[model samples]
Target chain A: MELVKRLLSGDMRAAARLITHIENELPDAREAIRLIYPHTGKAHVIGVTGSPGSGKSTLVDSMITEFRKKDKTVGVICVDPSSPFTGGAILGDRIRMGNHFTDKDVFIRSLATRGALGGLSKATKDAIRILDALGKDVIIVETVGTGQDEVDIVKAAHTVLVLSVPGFGDEIQIMKAGILEIADILVVNKADRDGADKLALELTLMVDLGHEEKADQKWKPLVLKTVATKNIGTPELIETIERHLQYLKSSNLLEINHKKNIEREIIELVNEHLINHLLGIMKEGDFEKLIEKIVEREIDPYSATDEILKKLYSN
Target chain B: MSYERKIRILVAKPGLDGHDRGALVLCHAFRDAGMEVIYTGILQTPEQIVETALQEDVDVVALSLLNGAHMTLFPRVRQLLIERNAEDTIVCGGGIIPEHHKPELIRQGITGLYGPGTLLDVIINHVVERVKKERWKIA
Candidate 1:
């Protein structure tokens, strides 16, 4: 309880502890968040995503370092795949940014997907809000690059960086359309590797082709090359991001997008809270009976749904 | 009813590196061992992880890290657990944890480290034993 109070008051330890409590999905964690939910919504959210092995982590580490150089506080949320069998997060991704653990200015967290179909967790948005409320100047969300679901989650960010690397071959094809559309900036990471230029050219052509399709869309996503491992070209990448941010601000898209994000978040929170509450009230035997009826074809899912809705509405 | 309660484990990938085959496999192995596992979907801050541990009221917090950021993330989570009086929760880790970092991890309060090729059964057995010990202590 004191930790919750401290978290609301902007205590870093309490914030960190609260985040862990939420990730673990502890009951008290929900109460703590409910208590502190009113104080969130100030940090700039940046989503970085790319194909597997595209150096997204390295790029994010570089960005955090750059943000720190400016004396800005940052939070990084690294999303890793959950074990499909056990429904637990296998948090192997944190090894890339090992150097910043002690840097008071940086707070990094990892989440395992827990069988969330889209490679994004339900708790992600709330976790972001917690970090935002904790007063992080910039909050970076790094998602696993596993097709459409991941791309959709990253689009929630003010700036989305879609990363690609050489030698990925056909996986690039899978990423081309879904992730490409949302990318504010395209990064050709691992630039030291051969084919980096070729990939960049291919990406540029793809973006051009997409623009041609969109016709009057004025915003053309910028493509940049970087060797994230060595931290080369990170400064230019950051500058491009800043320029894009300025563009969004000038065009007034920032406020519009922010408002939309808030609206979507509130809807989702209410929906989640309502569903959880209803489920809690349902008796286990009642759910089992419904399942049996469905299995026995005694009731169609549509009818069953109506019945369940009636029951939920009544209570 | 002689039903065995499934050991609930929370496996978390901390930091930004995203390779997760090892974590996935471990989750499968744990499930096969009859454990109820709650995966904290990816990019969880240390706070999210601790929160999940408490909320789920899980038996263990098993983390897998290939990216070298374990040094900071692990200790911070460990410290946070202590602060929350949840230090009784067993914290074990695995994945490409470098040989040199073992001493530091153990010293910093990680209960155990499982490297590549360590059998899931072995890890499960160890966890069962550890959890039993913890329960005995509490009892």
Candidate 2:
């Protein structure tokens, strides 16, 4: 509670502590979130995801610089995929954004997905809320940029920026449906490379073609190009983000998206809570017994789940 | 009670050291040990490392110094942690450190001074045990 008060007053250390608690899934984390939940819903949550080698980290680094130049306080959560073999992650994205490491106005934390296939949305959303409650003007969530399932970032943020680079081989195949569906702003990063223009054109054409149903919609997914390391086209990227935010506000899409995000958060929390609670009440080896039964084909998963649920709800 | 919390370690390459192969290896190694490793990448200052440890509330600060700045960077981190009242966070280092410098580094509160060819298990065991002992004491 003391930490929550400090976090509410914009204390960076408190914000960090709250994030650590959430990441560890500690007992007090829920209490802290409960106290700080009221102060959230103000920060603009942006999700940046793409494939490896897409320069996503450098692009996010540039975006942070752009946001800082405009005097905005930014909190960035760089989510790295946990190694399945080790449950550890090398969250090296901070190397690209270390330019802002010493800046008081900028707070960056790297989170490991912790082997969560759904990209650890539960902990990530809590970290974002803590940052939002701490009064960060813009909160950017950067993912490892893997594949379709990475779309979890979309449900967690208001604006999702999907990045891709040229010479990635078959640019058309790279701009698949999953990314185009979730992307509010599509970026062809590493734009100074060859086929930059061609890739941008392909993406623009794809965006225009895929979302034909929303022709009357004022906000179309804009495909911008950037060379992040050289800082080329970053200002334009910043402008595009601003334009999207403006459109979201004007169209009242912000409220709608916020509502959807809350619904998703509620479902995630409930799922996690129920699983943990069940595990707590179950006797030792009970779960393994159920797994064994399922493995031996003695009981189907649906029936086994129903049996467990009945036990859970019974006295 | 058995240790339950995740041991978050900040693997930092401080100073002008751009060669991060060792640091990168340690990141995955520690992670495989079921610890959360936050790689700060190369070219971090001592100040940045300490601040990251404070903010992240890491159980350990693992410094990989291939650029021979270990003497300064390691101790500076320890001192800063002390000043910040975060001495409970363990400070450790490795990479190209000469045997003679190990004593002084450990004397300054930097433990587990792993040098070249140190086994990954050696480092992991030291960290896992140290964190459990340290944290259990606090608990």
Candidate 3:
């Protein structure tokens, strides 16, 4: 509770320590977050995701600086994958964003995927809330160079910027329904590359096509080009992001979207808590026996699952 | 929802060291050992490194400097850690450090002075032990 009070008072040390607690799921962390929950939903949550090597981190670094120029405090959560075998990870995104290391207004934290397949840490949304409660005007969630199925960010962010680079792939890459479709803004970063113009053109066409399909859609997603490393077009990109935030505000979809996101989070938490509780009650030795039986075809997985659920829920 | 603690470590290179082969190799080594390692790349100042350590809340700050500023930069990072009230965040350094330099660095509360040809297992084991000890203090 003291940490929550300190965090609300904008103590960065308390903020950082609470994030570690959230990531590790310490006991007092739940209480701290519960106390901090009422003051959330102010900061604009932006999720930046794209394929690996599409300059996501570089773009985020530039975005942080741009937001600072506009006098906005920023919080960045950069996720890298954990090793499947060792459960450890090399979170090196700070390598590119080192410029803001000494900036007190900028808070950066790196998280390992921690076996989460969604290109994000399980604790991301909660950590975003902490930053929001700390009074950061902008919170950016940069996913581990994501693929098609890593669309979980759509539920966590108010605006999502999906970056694509030249030479990444053909039209099929963008045409996919998962990552690209979730974009509130599409950025052709590394636009100084050879195929930059063509990629931007294709994306523009795709945006137009989507608008034609949905005539009642008020906000049309924009396709912008930026060479994030050199900072070219970065200001325009930030302007677009700010414009999107304004749209969310004027339309009053910001709170509406926040509620929807929290609704989904509650469901996910229930499912996770139920499974964890079930795992706690189920004897591991018997669970291994069930697994052995299923692998040997002595019992089907569905039946085993049903039997376990039936046995546990009978109470 | 994990009860087991994960070791969060920062592998930073301070001063003008463009070469990061050793730092990166240790990154992979730590990953293999199941620790979360934050690498800020090369040319980082002691202040930047300390800020990173503070924000990331890392259990350890492992400095990898091949630019021969370890004597200055390493101790500088240590002092900043103390100044920032992060003395609980242990400090360690490795890279072309002279054998005679070990005691001075240790006296500054910077340990794990591993030089070249030191086995990866030894370094990993040292960090794991140190972090466990640090956690015991907290718990």
Model 2: share of true interface contacts reproduced:
0.64
lDDT of 2 by residue, A1-315 (tens): 899999988898899888988877788988998898888889998999888879888988999999999999999998877777756666677778878877888889888777677554347888999999999999999977667555788778888898878887675585656765788898888888899899889888877776686767667888888889988999998888888898899999999987887797788768978888887788899999999999999999999998788878883
Please give each candidate's TM-score: 0.72, 0.92, 0.97
**Candidate 1 lDDT, tens digit per residue, A12-82?**
66766676566657678778777777777667788898777778888898888888888889988878775
**Model 1 CA deviation exceeding 4 Å by range:** A8-10, A170-176, A212-216, A277-284, A313-315, B1-139
Query: Better model by lDDT, 1 or 3?
Result: 3
Q: Please state the CAPRI-style docking class of candidate 1.
A: incorrect
DockQ of each: 0.12, 0.59, 0.90
lDDT of 3 at A314: 68
Which residue pairs clash in candidate 2? A50-A145, A86-B32, A88-B31
Q: Model 1: how far is A94 from its true place, Å?
A: 1.1
Q: Model 3 - which docking category?
A: high
DockQ, model 1, C-alpha based: 0.12
Native contacts recovered, each model = 0.05, 0.64, 0.96
Task: Look at candidate 1 and tell me the lDDT of residue A196.
Answer: 88
lDDT-superior candidate, 1 or 2: 2
TM-score, B chain alone, candidates in order:
0.89, 0.92, 0.94
